[model samples]
Structure formats: structure tokens, C-alpha cells
Target: MERWVGKVAIVTGASAGIGAAVVEALAKQGLIVAGFARRKERVEELAKKLQGAKGKLYAVKVDVSKEKEVIEGFNWVKKNLGPVHILINNAGIIRNNTLIDGNSQQWEEVLVTNVFGLCVVTREAIKSMKENNVDGHIIHINSRSGHRVPNIPNINVYPASKHAVTALAETLRHEITRNNLKIKITSISPGYTETEIIEAAGLPKNNYKDIPAIKAEDVAEGVLYALGTPPHVQVGEVTLFAVGDKS
Candidate 1:
């Protein structure tokens, strides 16, 4: 955390949920954070609440699925906040459907946002780091489902996208090692977290009330933990779950 003070970080899907939590936590830790989201006003609202924090938050209007938008956002960061020292790939979506019979449009939407969008963001952020010679960290906000397919309902292609994330983290590490880049990759997989993604996907708020769940702040703490490690110690993966979470 001391090393990252005054440095810059970018967090996608930052308007709310885990993304918002991470933005607040990072800014409090003294890192200039850019919160990218389609609903820019929400980030701005959060920014107002952190008026006197150690660092600042800039809201960038971006829809991650669009490569052009993502690239532009990175450009803004480079021109203003300097090279990215940290990238949090937290923008993702899940649909309220099933594989046996699901809406094609919904499936495509999920894939484009959760999988392809993540790839584009990672690519641009890494490019920024390499060009500027910054030893950065990339944290993927993956789910426990990424490692194991959950038997929950209406998850549709979510688990598949997350599984892709699991592979991507490892693949990125190998690429970094082969290329001699100092970038570190870590996958923070949380189980049954209390977030709006599930409710937005048609899962009623009551469905998981009795079941175990963790708060978005808990995951944000885990992210800080991974980032606070010594430069030579790369925390490859961190899995967080409530005591009774079955997922």
C-alpha cells in the first residue's frame, strides 16, 4: 500500500458492487483511481463522498464491450493520471437464463461483456504498463464458479465466462514470465457475495437471504491484501467465501 501511494489504478464496472467497493478502498489507500462505467454519475457520486481522501477518483464513461471506448478510456488515463500501476478487471454480467433453453441474445450479451470485454481491458492496461516500464498488478474479480461449476439456477453462461477468467489469469502469468515483464496477475474468486449482479439477473433478494453471503467490501479487502504484498511476492490467487457458502 505504501508503494502504491500516489500511483494510478483503473477499476472497471466501478459504478457499484465490488467495483465501487474497490474504488473507495484504493482511493483511501492513496492511489489515484479511475472508475470506468456506463453510468458515470454513480462514480461521480461516490467521488463526492471521498472529497478529502488520500487520493482521488475520476469517472470515465465506458462500456467495456466496445474496444474503441476502452482504448479511449486508457488514453485518458495515460494522458492525465500517468501509466497504470494497477488494473482491476471487475466489469462482468450474468443473464437470467439457462442452457437447456435460453435466449440467444442474452447469452451473447453475457459473453461479450464478461469475457471479451475483460480481455480488451487487460490488453490495453498491459500495453500501457509495458510502454511506460511500470511494474503493475492486475487483479481479476473472478467468482468461485470460475474454479467449479456451481449448481445454481439461471446462471447460464456465467460459470463458463468465469472459468475462462481462471484460465486467463494463468495464461497471462505465463505470458508475463516469457516476456520478462514485471507485471503480476492475481485472481480473487469470491463465493456467494451479496451484490446487485445476482438481483439484476432476476435472482430475488430473498433467494439467498438464508444462504451464506459475503459483502462486497470483504472482496475489496482481499484485493488490497493481494496488492499490499511485497513486490517480489506475487499473490497468484485469493479465494474468499463465507463460512457456510456452498458455492
Candidate 2:
């Protein structure tokens, strides 16, 4: 943590949930944290609350699904804040529809936001890190669905997008290692987190209430642990689940 003080970090989907929690945690550790989200006002409100913290928080309007917005956001960070030292790819979405009867638009939305968005951000962040010679860390806020499909219904293409993320993490890791770049990549998968994403997916309230769930801050703690590790140590993947969660 001490090593990262006064450094720069970017957290996507930072208006709420896991992304918000990660932003707060990193900022408290004295890093210049940038919170990127479509709902820029929410991040601005959060930044106000974080006043007098160990580090500063900057709220940037960015829809990760948009390539132009992503590029501009990174450019702003580089010109204003400095090169990026850490990137937490936490932005994602879900739709409650089955494949056989699912709306293609819903599936596309899920894929664009959860998969393509992550890739764009990673590419831009890596460019900054490599150009500036920063041995940074990249974390994907993946889901248990990335590893295995839950028994729940109507998850649609959400799980498939996550599985792509799972593979992307490894693919990026190999690419970085082969290039002799010191950048580290990790995939943190959490099972059934208590976040708005579930509700937004249109799951019944009773469904999630009956299941074991982890808090967003718990997942943030995992990110902290990963970032706090020695430079030589790279946590490849971390899967988190509530104690009683069967899946």
C-alpha cells in the first residue's frame, strides 16, 4: 500500500456497488483515484464525501461501452493525473432473459458492456503503463458465473460475457509475460454479491434474499489484498463466495 501512495488508479463502474467500494478503498490508501461511470453525478457526490481522505478522488463521465468515451477518459487521466498505476475493470451489466427466447438486443447490451468495455479500458490503460514504464496491476471484477453457471434461471448472456472475461484475464497475462512487461493481471470472481446488479437484472426480490451473498466491500478487500502484495507476487485469480452459498 505504501508503494502506491501518490500513484494513480482508475476504477470503472465507480458510481456504485463494487466499483464504488474499490474507489473508496484505494483513495483511502493515498492513491489518486479516478471514478469512471455513466452516472457521473453519483461519483461526484461520493467524491464530496471523501474529502480529507489520504488521497483525492476525481469523477469522470465515461460509459465503458463507448470506445470514444473510454479513450477520452484515459487521455484526460494521462494529461491531468499522470500515468495509470492500477486499473480495476469493475464495470458490467446483466439481463434477465433466456437464450431460446432472449432478446438479441439484451444479449448485445450485456456483451458490449461486460466484455468489449473491459477490453477497451485494458488496452488504453496498458498503453499508458507501458509508455511510462509503470509496473501496474489490472483486476477484472468477474463473477462466479465466469467459472460456472448458477442454477438460477434467465441469466441469459451474462454468464457468457463473464466467461469471456475469465479467458481474457489469462490471455492478457500470457501476453504481458511474453512481452517481459512487469504489468500484472488478476481476475477476482465473487459469487452472488449483494449489489444492485441483481435487482437490475430483474430477479425477484425473494430469490436473492433467500441466497447467501457477499458485500461489495468484501470484494474490495480482496482487491486491496491483491494490490498490497509484493511486486514479485501476482495473484492470478481469486474466487469469493458467502459461506453458505452452495454455488
Candidate 3:
């Protein structure tokens, strides 16, 4: 944490939920944070509230699903905030449809945003880190679904996309190791987090209310725990779940 003070960090899906929480936590730690999301206004509002904090916050309009927008956002950060020292790939989505008889568009949307979007952001961020000789850290906001399929229904390809994330984290680590790069990659998987994502996925509001769930802030705390480790310590993965959650 002390070493990261005055450094730059980029957090995707930062308009709200876990991403927003992470942004606020890092800013308080004196790290310049760039919040990237399509809902630029929301992040702008958050930035205003974070004024006078130990660090600063900037809002960047970006839809990680769009390659061009991702590239532009990274370029802007490099030009204004210098090289990226940390990247939190927190953008993800879940559609209400079953793979047995689901809409192709919905499936594509999940894959594009959850899988492809993460890859694009990682690539661009790594490029900046390498060119600048920064030993950056990349954290993926994965889900319990990434490790195993949940018992929930109509999740469609959401779990599949997350499973891909599980693989991506390992693949990126291997790639970095092969090149002898000091960059670190980690995957943080949380189970049934209380966020708008569940409602947006078309689940009944009561469904989440009745279940044991972790707050978005709890997950943010996990992010800080990972980032605060010693330089020689690389946390490969951190999985969190509510105590009451059976699975």
C-alpha cells in the first residue's frame, strides 16, 4: 500500500457496485484511480464526492466490450495519469436465459462483455506497463460460478464466461512468467454478492433478499488485501462467500 501511493490504477465497471467500492478504497489509499464505465455521469458524480481524499479520481467513458473504446481509454490514462500500476477488470454481465433454449444475442452479450472485454482491457494495460517498466498488478472480479456452476436457474452462459476467466487468470500468469515479467495477476471470486447485477439479470428481488450474500464493500476489502501484499508475495486467487451460503 505504501509503495502504491501516488501510482495510477484503472478499474473497469466502476460506475457502481464492487467497482465503485474498489475505486473509493484505492483513492483513500493515495492512488490516482481512473474509473472506466459507459455510465460516465455516475462515475463523475462519485468523483465529486471523493474530493479532498488522499488520492484523486477521474472518470473515463468506456465500454470494455468495445475494443476501440478500451484502447482510447487506456491511451487517455497514459497521457494524463502516466503508466498504469494496477488494473481491476471488474466488468461483467449475466443474462436471463438458459443455454438449452436461449437467445443467441444474450449469449453473445455475456461472452463479449465478461470474456472478451476483460481480455482487451488486460492486453492494453499490460502493454502500457511493459513499455513503462512497471511491475503492475491485474485483478479479475470473477464469481463463484467461475469455479463451479451454481444451482440457480436461467443463468445461460454466465457461468461459462466466468470459467473462462478462471482460465484466463492462470494463462496470463504463465505468459508473464514465461517472459520473466514482474507483473502479477490474481482472480477474486465472490459468491452471491449483493449488487444491482442480480436484479439486472432479471432475478426476483426477493430471491437475493432471502439469500445470504456479501456486500459490495466486502469484496472491495478483498481487493485491498490482495493489493497490500509484499512485492515478493503474489496471491494467485482469493475466493469469498457468505457464511450462510451452503455452496
Candidate 4:
């Protein structure tokens, strides 16, 4: 929105999929956006293409799974771009395995990336916002599985991680209100989306092909809708999926 023009926004896991789309949209809205991902070159490449947009995009190489790296990335953003006005916690991962006999390493990876990583980034971003006395917004890109377990198999601990996101948003909201902070927290859960996550998770190719899905851009639009509202109007949660999606 015009109110946040020239302000700073951070999008994690921003090299591709939902993260990429969200960051690009924020940049075009005139926010100084930073796209953080381990595949820094991918974000940098996109940044190059967005050079003529209303705002600037910076690519920061960060693997959100590590706390030290996350801290450093936040420091860079603070020192260079002032404080965070918006934060899109979009970094997440899913492994194709069942919980009963699933690979422990894979589950650990998912927990680290989806749960712990998100918390660390949020802490830093909220810290920046509080320190600067800015009323910022934090949006968590969750999944429908967070609300209900899907019928699909081998979703592993993905749903559990997302459920944590659902609880986290509420907890953060409570904390904000108790602390008398003006910050807003929202969780936007999207159903099966067309993204590299499916392929990267090694889901069955045929299943992905048959599943009706929404575009990553659609989720990005929902994010903008949340950010476009007035400060007093806190858009607590949004759930979006393709019309034909039965899941």
C-alpha cells in the first residue's frame, strides 16, 4: 500500500514458488524487499529482472534452518534498510515419508526448516519492528493441512508443522496485545499450490498432475490483501484453494 512505500519487507525461502511471488509483489508495491534463500543466485536473478519496478529487491543468501545465518541476515537488513515493516515467513519444506517408519533425518529437516526457522526469523523481525517503534505485519504462509489432516498419504509431519504455524500466529497475536504492541499477525493457508515444493518433496508425479491447484501468484494476492487493510483492521486468517480442490 502507499503507506508502506519505501519501507522494508523480508521474504524468506524467496528463491522460488510462493516466496518468490510474494517478494516480487511486495517489491512492486514500493517496499524495499529482501528475498532470502540458500539459492541466492535464483533470487539475484529475479532481482535483476525486477530492476525497473517501483521498489528495489535485494537477495540475501540465507538458509533459515540455521539460527546464526538468520541472525546475520536480519542484521544486514536492519543496518542497510532500517527496520522491518513487513515480514513474510514463507520458508518451508516437506519430505515424502510416513511418520511411522519415516526417515528421522527427513523429519528433523522439516521441523528445522518449517518450525524452528520460522520462529527465529520472526523473533528477529519483530525485534526490529519493536526497536524502531513501527507497527509492522507478519504473515505466515501456512497450508490447509494445518487446520485438517488431508486424505492424501505420506504427508508426514508437514501438517503438524503447519499446525504449529496456526498456533504460532494466535500466540503471537496474544503476545502483541498483552505487550501493547501495534503489530499484526496473520496466517494464510493455501491448499495444493503449483510449485517446486511438490516435485522437491518427491510426491508422485501423476498425483501432482491430477490434483487441482492454485497458482503461487494467487496466494501472493491474498498476502497483499492482508497488507492493504487499515492498521486497525487486522486480517487474522485467510484460507484459499482452487474451486475444484476437494482437499
Give the C-alpha miss distance for residue 29 in model 3, angstroms.
0.6
Worst 10 residues of 4 by lDDT: 203-212
Residue 186, candidate 3: how far off, in angstroms? 0.7
User: Tens digit of lDDT per residue, candidate 1, span 45-115?
Assistant: 99999989999999999999999999999999989989999999999998888899899999999999988
lDDT of all the models against the reference? 0.94, 0.94, 0.94, 0.94
- Summarize candidate 3's per-residue lDDT along 217-245 as a digit string, tens digits: 99999999999999889999999999989
lDDT score, candidate 2, position 158: 86
TM-score per model over all chains: 0.98, 0.98, 0.98, 0.98
Model 2, 10-113: lDDT tens digits are 99999999999999999899999999999999999999999989998999999999999999999999989999999999999988888998799999999999
Candidate 1 vs. true structure, TM-score: 0.98
Off by over 4 Å in 3: none
Q: Against the hidden true structure, what lDDT does model 1 obtain?
A: 0.94
